[model samples]
Target: MSLGGKVWITWTRKTKSNYVGKIILAAALTALCILMLKQSPSFNSRSPFSNHEPGVTHVLVTGGAGYIGSHAALRLLKDSHRVTVVDNLSRGNMGAVKVLQELFPEPGRLQFIYADLGNAKAVNKIFAENAFDAVMHFAAVAYVGESTLDPLKYYHNITSNTLVVLEAMAAHGVKTLIYSSTCATYGEPEKMPITEETPQLPINPYGKAKKMAEDIILDFHKNSNMAIMILRLFHPHVSFFHYFSLSVKTQMARLGEAPRPELREHGRISGACFDAARGIIPGLKVRGVDYKTPDGTCIRDYIDVTDLVDAHVKALEKAMPGKVGIYNVGTGRDQSRSLLRHVRRLTGVNIKVDFLPRRPGDYAEVFSDPSKILLELNWTAQYTDLQKSLGIAWRWQKLHRNGYGTSVTIADS
Candidate 1:
C-alpha cells in the first residue's frame, strides 16, 4: 500500500472517535439539565407523585395525634386528601390517632408515624419517601405554665424544630405550610377584639417561641417559593358532642361498624366543668377573677374546635405560592361569667367555683376580630351559641369519663 493511503485512513478514524465523544458529552449535559429542572420547585409542574391524578394533594400533618392536630387530620381525611401524621407522642395522644383511625377506616387515606420534627434525619426521610403537597404544622409544646417553667423545651420544640421542618420542606420542594399559631402571640392586647394588626408583644415563653417560629417561616417564604398561612387561633373549645360522638364512634368501631356522622362544635372548658359536676375533679378553679374586666375575670375568645380545624382546611386550599396569609381564628366574643354559667346549665349541677389568684402571664382580655378570615376565606364560626356548644361537651364528658376510652388523661383545657 502507499504511505498517503495509510495516513488518510488513520486521520479518518481519529476524527470519527472525537465526533462520537462530543455527542456522548452533549447527551450527558442534556440529561443533567432535565434532572435539575424536574427537581426545582420553580420548574417542576407536578408533585413527586406524578402518577397520581391532579388536584389530589397529599398533606403532612405534623403532630397529627394531638387535640387540634387530630381534628385537622380528620378534616383533611374527610376532604379526600391523603394525610400522613407525624408525632413523637411526647404531648400528643395515640388514643386520638386511634379514634381517628376508627373515624377514617379507609385504607391509605390516613397514616401515622411515631416521629419528631426535631429529628432532622427522620423529617427528611419522611419528606423523601412521600410526595407532600403541603404541610400543616401543629406539633409544639404549648402549655403556657409549662413553657414558662421550661423555656428551653419550648424554644427547642417550637422554634428549632420548626426550622428543621422548614429546611426539609425547602430541600424537598414542599411549598405550602399552614402553621398552627396562637393568639398568645398578641399577649395582652391594649383593646378589645384584637385584630390581625394587633402588636405581637408576647409575655410568655410559649408565645415567644411560636412567634419565633412564625418569623422563621416568613424568612423561608422570603427566600423560596413557599406559600405560608399562619392561623392565630384564640381559645378553641371542643363541644361535648365531639367527645360524645368520638367516644361512641370509637366503641362502635370496635364492633366493625361505621362511625356516626360528625357534628360541628367542640368544647375545651366544658370538659373540666363536666369533670367537676361528675365529681371527677373536686371543682373548677377560676383563674384570675380580678383582672380588671367587667366580671373581674380574664376574658377570652373561644371558638369551636370544628370551626378552627375548618379554618386550617380553607387556608390550605387558598394558600398561594410566594404569598403569606395571616388570620385570627375565633368567634369574636369575650366571655367569662357567661361561659361558667353555660357550663352550669349544661351539667345541671351547681358547679362550685374556687376563686384563685390570677396565674402568671395571664392576659386581661384577648378576643379576635376574625372579620379578615370571614371575608377572605369565607369561614365563619357556625356554633356561636355558647350554651349549645357546652351542652354537647357535657354529654361527651358524661359518657367518656375516662376520656377517649384510654387511661391517659387528655388535657381538658
Candidate 2:
C-alpha cells in the first residue's frame, strides 16, 4: 500500500473510534439519570402540571371546609394559587365549601373532594389522581372534651390518618407539608407565655393525638426531603379580613367562621358567646371559675383567623427540603374575662352568664410567645384589638342567626 493511503485509513479508524466512545458515554449518562429519577422522592412527587404560570403553587388542603382550613383555602385562592380541599364533612361545614366555590367559580381554581382520611385507600387514590405540590394537613378531631370522651376517634382521625397521609406523600413524591397542630399539646404550662421550647406534656387526648402526629411527621422528615412545618396554633377567634387585599368587614363576613350547631359546643369562646347573644341559647355558661388566673377563668391566647392563615402561608413559603420548622402561632395575649366583656359590648346585649364547674382538661392559663414565628417568618398579629375583632365576628353572627342556615334574620339585640 501507498504511504498516503495508509495515513488516511488510520485517520478514518480513529474518527470512528472517537464517535463510538461519545455514543457510549451518552448512553451511560442517560441510564444513570433514569436510575436517579426512579430513586428520587422529589422528582417523583413533582406535579405533572409543573409548567403552570410562574409563582403559582398547587396545594392540597385537607379539611379545607373547616374553620381554619376554609380560611387558609380562601387566602391561597386569593393569592392566585390552585387549591384542592378534601374533607368528609364530619366536623367541617359544606356551606363554607359552597361559599368558596361560589367565590372562585373558575375551573381549576378550587376543588372539593368528600373523602375521609381514615380510608387509606381513598387517600392514596386522591394523591395519585392529583399532582399536589404541597399539602396542608388540617383535618383532625380537635375538640379536647370530645377527644377525651372518644379517644379512639381522636387517634384514628388525627394520628393514624396522619400516618396514612405521610405514607401517601412518600409514595406519590409530594414534599411540602404544613401541619395544623394546637397549643393544647402544651397542656397547662408552668409559664405564662408558652414558647416553642415548652415541654409537650399534653393533658388531653386531643393534644396527645396531635403530638403523636407530630412525631410521625418528624420521623418521616428525617429520612426524606419533605419540608415540614408544624404550627402550634392557639384558640382561634372568629373574625374576618383579607390579608392580601382589603375587603370590608361585611364582605369578609361572607367567609366568616360558622361551626355546625352540634360542634359549636366544642368551638371557640367567641362562637358560644355569640350564640348566647343571639338568643340561640338561654345564656352563656362560663366554665371553670376557680382557676389560678385573676378572674378564675381559663385564660388562652386567641389568634385571629386571618393571622393564623397568614402564618400557614408564610410557613409554606419558608419550607425547605430536609428542614423542619415548629412555631407557636398566637397573639401572645390572654383572653379570659375580657373576651366576654368584649362580646357583650359589641353585640349590645347583656348576655346572661352562668358559672359552671371547670370543664375536664381545662387549663389555668395557656398563651404563646410568638417571637420565633415573628423572627423567622416575619409574621405578627395585626388584629390585636380584642373588641374590634369580636365586633367583626358579631356582625356576621347577627346576620346568620342560625349559623350558616338560610333563615337569616337581623338580630333585635
Stretches off by above 4 angstroms in model 1 are 1-53, 240-268, 406-413
Tens digits of per-residue lDDT, candidate 1, 275-312, equal: 67888668887767778888788788888887888899
lDDT of 2 by residue, 16-120 (tens): 999999999999999999999999997776443433446669899999988889989999998889999999998788988988888889967888899999999
- What TM-score would each prediction reach against the true structure? 0.80, 0.84
For model 2, the stretches where C-alpha displacement exceeds 4 angstroms are 1-54, 242-253, 407-413
Using TM-score, give the best candidate's number.
Answer: 2
lDDT, candidate 1, equals: 0.78
Clashing pairs in 1: 237-266, 238-266, 238-267, 238-268, 239-266, 239-267, 240-392, 240-393, 241-392, 289-296
Q: What is the C-alpha lDDT of each candidate?
A: 0.78, 0.85
Which 10-residue window in model 2 sums to the lowest lDDT?
244-253
Question: What are the clash counts of all predictions, listed in order?
Answer: 10, 1
